[model samples]
Target: MKINFSSKTKILLYFSVALILGFSIINTVSFFYIKSYIDKNLSKDVEIFKRIYMYEDQSKLIPYLKIVDSNQNINQNDIVGKVDGKYIVVDKGKVYTELIHFIISISLWEIFILFIILIIANHLVQITIDKEKELKGILEVFILALTHKIKNFLGIQRVNIEILKINFNEKALMRLEKAYMLMEKDFEILIQALKSLREFRDKREEIDLKTVLEEIIKELESIYPEKSIFIKLSSFKVKADRTDVKNIFFVILENAFKYSEKRIFITDSMEKNIYTIKVLNDISFQEKGSGVGLEIAKFLANKYNWEIFNQSSDDEYIVYIKIPKK
Candidate 1:
């Protein structure tokens, strides 16, 4: 049978196993040490008692006195003592019991200390694992975002290069210049994204959705001049981080143009306290993508309590982003 254990459970299991093994080892070592201690002391006590019985008065050590001659048979409970070439039996149960109790007490205290150390070690390990996981997630997201942005900029540069190859005129030169400027803009956006990621809970301000959409549309037109685009947006306002909002729009629109046919449509409306924007494009249903852009967009939307929905048919793909007017 397979037992599934979560991270916390696994850590606890490791600690428990270590504790049990440690306790067993300590107990075994303590038992041997205690046995040796008892044997050594008992021998010393027997020798001392033997000397006392031989040379001193009989009444002096009555409590420890247990004398038996060579002819007298010793029972199971009797400890043998030799004095002056003769044998005597003595009872050592009281002293043995006292030593056993002391050793057990010391062992329990040591185990308690070991238990505390294990608990602290487990806690530290858990914290380290959590931080590592968080760092890994951040790195993955950063790499995906960076790669997507670079690919988009490169596509524009490739197009300009193609134009230059066909005709080396003012218009081609201007297109090249535009590509370079877009590259610079892409770099700036990346820097701003990194800064925003560091301070993800930045203060929100009233954002003009209409203005943001117009700017994105213009940018897309410059990159894909051959593609037909339509936009119909009414005035809408939302409280959000400006960079986050811009990045969301950019990623969605860029994806739409990249994956769609020659046409794309965008529309927006505001009703009551909610504003919704929808983007629709034509694409083959079988086409698949890494979907990093949409993932990032949805992440940002969820972070700001906005709602995002996606729908796709055999020939049409649509996304709706709904934000609360604040």
Candidate 2:
């Protein structure tokens, strides 16, 4: 079984590993540091007083310091060490032992405190993430509901407009028809905007490259008659969701015409099972558009074996999309 971790989870795991490793090294190094301190300093004391009974009278001055003769048997605190180029028996008791214990205990306490902080931080982060997820679910539901209501209202307006078109004179009807076009376009945009972008694949089938591009071009021709589009599509069928592929191409082509100064070029290339589409146009530099079409295409591209990227300069904009071809 495979488990996929989020980026946040990966970061937290890395931090936790480093935290453990860092403290482990600190404790190890600290133990050795104190080991050498006791070896050098306490061993020298044994060289000064060569017998355990020699320090018995000075017990109040140096507690737990038991320096003894080389042949003397030591208690639990005894250790064999070299002092002044001679062998000695030494018992460095609570003085050095307490220091070692204090150091290790302090490191453990630090580890405990930091681990508690990490737990609290992770708990807070998880809470925030849960809240965000809940808010996103609520927002998606709200937008879906609002868009649906607007779609129904727009459908009614479309029907009433079509019915009343017969009653108006030529001049009034022309104005009404233009207004109708604007309303339909706006509603189409609204529907596209709120449509569940997360659902990219409702159905997958072979979609012809040339036919879909030409159909999308025809729709734009009625809207932007002055713009010229030159298409050079490769002969291939792309195995993908029809609506998704169409929406992506439509957005690319529509943006080309909508923002082009005069000329828009459409071309495609195929290699093995991959098809690449390129849309190139000179920037119009007119009133900027909403670019909701390209946004929709980008959202769809992220979900499939498709790639969409673009480059632009002061005068030209070029976009490329790579898709799987059957």
Model 1 over residues 51-136: C-alpha lDDT tens digits?
67755565356455466676766774674566665666655666567667876787788778877877888788888786667546
| Model 1 stretches with alpha carbons more than 4 Å out | 54-65, 68-73, 83-87, 90-92, 166-326
Worst 10 residues of 2 by lDDT: 193-202
- Locate the minimum summed-lDDT window of 10 residues in model 1: 56-65
**Candidate 1 global TM-score:** 0.50
Candidate 2: residue 152 lDDT (0-100): 48
lDDT of 2 by residue, 1-326 (tens): 99999956976788788887887888778878988887787656654555443444745644555345556545544655444344444445565678767786888797897789689868877877865674465356445544654564466566557756767456444545544554465456446534633442257787787898998888778777788888887677766677667767876886787679999998988788778889999999775545445655776665575888888899999999988753
Clashing pairs in 1: none
Displacement of residue 74 (Cα, Å) in model 2 is 52
